[model samples]
Target: MLRALRTAALGMSAQQTSVDNTANNLANANTTGFKRATVVFQDLLYQSVQRGGEGDQRPAAMQLGSGSAIVATQRTFLQGSLMQTGNSLDLAVNGEGFLQARRPDGSVVYTRDGAFTLDADGRIVTQSGLALEPDLEVPPETQEIQISSDGVVRVRLQNEPDALEIGRIEVAQFSNPAGLRSIGANLYEQTEASGEPQIGPPAEGGAGLLQQGFLETSNVDVVQEMVDLITAQRAYEMNSKMITTSEEMLQIANSMKR
Candidate 1:
C-alpha cells in the first residue's frame, strides 16, 4: 500500500511538470524567436518483491515502479514562423544560431528572437533593449540603414547613393543544446554539460543567416498543446485513482485482520 501511494505521488508529480511545460509553451506561442521545450521523464527503480531461486521457488516479481522523474527539459531546435516586420533594425535568423546580446551587468546572453530596435543613442537593441554584441552603433548623421543577409550592418552616406559598412552581428552556437538549462527570461545559461558556446558571424559555420525586417515567431502548435493538456489531466486523474485503489486495498486488509 505504501509503495502504491509513493508510486502514485511520483506519477502525478511528473505529469504536473509535463502540464507546466506545455502551458509555458502555449503562453509563448506568439513570442518572437521563442523555442518550445518538451519534458523528458524516466521511471524510478523497480523493487523485486519475489526473489528468484531454484527448487520450486518462484521467479522474481517486479514492482511497477516507485515513480517517475523529470529527466530533462529538452529545447526544440525546430524552426519557428518567420514573419516580416519591415523595420530597418528588425532582424530574424533565417537558419540556426542565436544573436548575442550584452546585459546591463556586462554579462553576455543569447537569443533567437531577432526583433531588434535602435535606441536613442543609435545603438541596436532588442525590444527589451539589450544591446547587440559586437556593439553595432550607427553614426548620428546616418540617414538610412541596411543589414545584409550575412549580418553586416551598414548606413547610407549623406548626399551619397551607397551605404557604408559598420559592423557584423555576432551569433553563438552550441554542441549539446538539449543540455541547456532554462533560467527563465526566455534565456538559457551555459553549463559544462552543454559545452562552451561557439561565437561567430551570422551564417558562418553552422550559424544561421540573418534576415533583415523579419522576426522568428514561436514554434508552439496550439492544437498540439491542447491535446497534451488533456493527456496530462487524464494521467493525473489516473494517479489519483491508483491512490484510492491502494487505500481501499489497505482497508480490506485491515477488515480481514479484525
Candidate 2:
C-alpha cells in the first residue's frame, strides 16, 4: 500500500511538470519566434526480487519499477509561421538560425525574434534596447531602409539618388540548438551542450534567409497544447484516484480482526 501511494505521488509530480510546460506554451502561442517545449520522462530504477534458479524451469528475475520522473524539457526548433506586418524593421528567418544580440554587460545572446528598431544613436536594436550584433548604424538623413534576402542592409538617403549599402546581418547556428538556456525576453544563451555558435550571412551554411517586413510567429500549436493539457490533467486525476484507492485498501486491511 505504501509503495502504491509513493508511486502515485511520483506520477502526480511528473504530471504537474507536464501541465506547467503546456501552460507556458499556450501562453506564448502568439509570441514572436517562440519555441514550444515538451517534457521528457524516464522510468525510475526497479526493485528486483526472486532471482531465477539455473536449470529449474523457473522464470527470470522479477522487478517492480519505482515510477517515473521528468528527466528533461526539450525545446522544439520547428519553423514558425510568418506574419506579414509590413513594418520595415520587422524580419523573419525562413529556416534554421538565430539573430545575435548583445546584452548590457556585452555578453552575446541568441534569438529568433527579428522585430528590431533603431535606438537613439541610430544603431539597430531589439525592442528591449539591446544592440544587434555587428553594430549597424543608420545615417541621420536615411530616408528608407531595405534588407535583402542575403542579409544585406541598404538605405536610401534623403538627398541621395542611389541606395547605399550599410551592413549585412548575419545569423548564428549551433550543433544542438535545443541545448541553449532560455533567459527570457526571447533570448537564448549558449551552453557546452549547445556547442559554439557559427556566425555567417543568411542563406549560407544551413542558416535561414532573411524576410523583410515579416516576423516569425510562435511555433506553438494551440490545439496540440490543449490536447496535451487535457492528457496531463487526466493523468493527474488518475494518480490521485490511485492514492485514494490505496488508502482505502489500507483502511480495509486494518479493519480485519485477528
Candidate 3:
C-alpha cells in the first residue's frame, strides 16, 4: 500500500508538470519567436520479480519501482509561419538559426522574434527595446528604411535616391539547442550542454536567411498538446485508483479480529 501511494504521488507530480507546460504554450500563443516547451518524463528504477522455477533459486528479488521523474524539458524549434507587418524592423528567419540580441544587462541572448522598433537614439531594437548584437543605427533624418535579402540595413536619404547602408544583422546557432535555458520574455540563454553559440552572418552554416518586414509566429501545435493532455489525465486517474484500492485492502486487513 505504501508503495502504491508513492507511485500515485509521482504520477500526479508528473501530470502537474505537463499541465504547466501546456498552460505556458497557450499563454504565449501570440508571443513572437516564443518556442513552446514540453516536459519529458521517465519511469523510476524498477526491480525484477522471480520468473522461472529453476532460475528462481537466484531469489526473484521482489519487484520494486520508484515513481516517475522529470527527465527533461524539450524545446520545439519548428519554424513558424511568417506574418508581414510592413515594418522594416520586423524580420523573420526563413530557415535555421536565431537572432542575437543584447540584453539590458549586457548579456547576449538568442531569439527568433524579429518584431523590432527604433529607440529614441535611432538604434534598431527588438519589440522589448533590446538592442541587436551588431547594433544597426539609422540616421534620424532618414525618411524610409530598407533591409536587403542578405540582412543589410540601410535608409533613404533626402538628397539621394540610393539607400545608404547601415549595418548587417547577425544570426547565431548552437550544436544542441535543447540544452538552452528559458529566461522568459522570449529569450534563451546558452549553457555548456548546448555548446557555445556560433556567431555568423545570416544564411551561413545552416543559419536562417533573414526576411525583412515579417515576424515568425509560435510553432506550437495545439492538436498535439490536446492529445497529450488526454493521455496524461487518464494515466493520472488510473494511478489514483491503484492507490485507493491499496488503501481499501489495508483497511480490510486491519479490521480482522485481533
Candidate 4:
C-alpha cells in the first residue's frame, strides 16, 4: 500500500507538469515567433521482486517500476505562418533559420521574431532594442528602404533618383535547433547540444529567405493544446483515485490489527 501511494503521487506530479506545459503553449498561441513545447516523461527505476536461481525454469526476474517522472520539455522548431504587416521594417524568415541579434550584454542570440524597428540611431533593432547582427544603419534623409528576398538592403536618398545598396541580412542555422535554450522574450541561446551556428546569407546554404513587411506568427495549435490539457486532467484524476484507494487499503489493514 505504501508503494502504491508513492507511485500514485509521482504519477500525479508528472501529470501536473504536463498540464503546466500545455497551459504555457495555449497562452502563447498568438505570440510572435513562439514555439510550442511538449513534456517528455520517463519511467522511474524498477526494483526486482524475485530473482530466479541458476538453471531454474522460472523467468529471470520480476520487477516493478517505482513510477514516472518528467524528463524534458522539447520545443518544436517548425516554421510558423507569416503575417503580413506592411510596416517596411518588419521581416520574416520564409523557411528554416533564425535571425541573429546582439543582446544588451553584447552576446549574440538567435530569434525567429522579425518584428523589427529602427532605433534612435536608425539601426535596425528588435522590439527590445537588440540591434540586428552586422548592423545596418539607415541614413536620416532616406526616403525608402527595400529588402530583397535574397537579403539585399537598399535605400533611396531624399533627392536621389536611384537607390543605393546599403547591406545584406544574414541568418544562422544549427544542427539541433530544439536543443537551444529559451531565455524568454522569444530569444534563444545556443547550447552545446545545438552545435555551432552556421552563419550565411539568406536563401543560400539552406538558410531561409527574408521577407520584408511581414512577421512570423506563433506555431502553437490551440486545438491540439486543448486536447492535451484534457488528457492531462484525466490522468491527474486517475492518479488521485489510485492514491485514495491505496489510503483506504492502509486504513483497512490498520483496523484488522485492532
TM-score of each: 0.92, 0.97, 0.93, 0.97
lDDT of 3 by residue, 46-89 (tens): 86655534463653356678789788889988888898888877
lDDT, candidate 2, 1-258, per-residue tens: 899999999999999999999999999999999999999999998897656764675778778888899999999999999999999989999999999999989999999999999999999999999999988999999999999998999999998999999999999999999999999999999999999999999999989899999999999999999999999999999999999999999999999975
User: Which residue window of length 10 is worst by lDDT in model 4?
Assistant: 50-59
Per-model RMSD to reference: 2.0, 1.2, 2.1, 1.2
- Give residue 18's lDDT in candidate 3 (0 to 100): 85
| Candidate 1: segments with Cα more than 4 A from true spot | 51-64
Computed on alpha carbons, the lDDT of every model, listed in order, comes to: 0.84, 0.95, 0.84, 0.93
Question: Candidate 2 has which clashing residue pairs, if any?
Answer: none
Q: Which ten contiguous residues of candidate 3 have the minimum total lDDT?
A: 51-60
- lDDT score, candidate 2: 0.95
Clashes within 3 Å, all models in order: 0, 0, 0, 0
Superior by lDDT: candidate 2 or candidate 4 = 2
Off-target runs (Cα >4 Å) in candidate 4 are: 52-55
| CA error at residue 232 for candidate 2, angstroms | 0.8
Error of 1 at 180 (Å): 2.8
